[model samples]
Target: VRGTMRHLLVLALAAALLPVASVAAEESDVVVLTSQNFEHDTQASTGATTGDWFVKFYAPWCGHCKKLAPVWDELATELKGVVNVAKVDAEAHSSLRKRFRIRGYPTLIFFSQGKMYKYEEKRSLESLVAFAKGGYKDDTEAVDVPAPPDLIATLKGEFFGLLKTVLHYSKHPEAISQESAYFLAAGIVIGSVLASAFYLFLSLASPAPAKRVSQSKKGD
Candidate 1:
């Protein structure tokens, strides 16, 4: 009886750990993308080709996004070697969020051959896998992916990202670390210069103001 009980305990422990191991395996197949490396990762011109990317832009706290997490993991597993599956935390990566114009809790985009095909169908495992495999081919309305940000746009985006961080630090002084303070000060100066240069360019391009003509009663 003692040996039987020990065997049962081991079985129960194995059962408990199985799901965790499965979830980890599923997650391992999906790439975690961020604002810093997404450009190089997604752009065809940057590095060796790694197939197409099927990216999900999601917010952590969103109920819809949470509901789809398991299905997304399954989708990643299904497309493991066929397509590059990835996810972006849009709430945390403002630059990517702005670049993609992601306004919803969950947005799905498939990048193929430097073009983007939006997934507007159901988010089920089958639908996702099918779309990742070949739905972009049938879709006639593939949108051309926007070119990567230029130097000025990159600087502006970084400055805005830094400004948000500084504002957060202002509300919570305890979170302000030494490195954060140094970056915040430098970012402010650079951001000011970029802002001034942008406004100067706009001012130069704008039409000159019309001059008001004055009549002195015909020199009477």
Candidate 2:
């Protein structure tokens, strides 16, 4: 009789706490998921399920992640029931981290229909919603994503990317064209000048390396 009473008491306690749990869920829009609950929450949203999920992979110590926290709160409030917003702490959950291949902190991914879409747009609420609409597609499809507003930055990035590729393949330094050689020399000169300036400043600020009289050798 006592064992049965104890079981009933446990059930009653769970029932009493249900309302509190529901109210808490109602209060917050974002779901804090760990490695434990990730598969269940995300997988259910696809097969036989009906919700779209937007999840953030973050590390707490990352400054970008810290700045993104409040934005996430706003995203949660705005997305609310329309889309399920969630976060996974990449540092704490190694499995999810590796599974998603999150190379940088504050990586955002949207999951729908057994496919995951990466969000590469600017980290803004509006941008995120736009991505939800059509910024991404399945892995096999070619997504012709437009460049961000800053065209100069985009072109510069492409230029540097091409430069790295060429440099990596060019076995001999002479493989570089004459024009490129001039530019490379200029870059090296500026870098060396800055490094030398820093080194001189540090040398001046540091304590004297050795007493001049040390040459006397303790007595003389």
Q: Note the Cα lDDT for every prediction shown.
A: 0.66, 0.56
Per-model TM-score versus the true fold: 0.59, 0.49
lDDT of 2 by residue, 110-165 (tens): 87766667777789888777676656663324322221223233223323332332
Off by over 4 Å in 1: 1-27, 44-48, 155-220
Residues 76-147 of candidate 1 have per-residue lDDT tens digits of 888988998898866545667787789897999998887788898998999888888887778647877766
User: TM-score winner among the candidates?
Assistant: 1
Q: How many clashing residue pairs are found in candidate 2?
A: 0
Candidate 1: TM-score?
A: 0.59
Q: What is the C-alpha RMSD of each candidate to the true structure, in Å?
A: 19.3, 25.9
Worst 10 residues of 2 by lDDT: 16-25
Off by over 4 Å in 2: 1-27, 44-50, 138-220
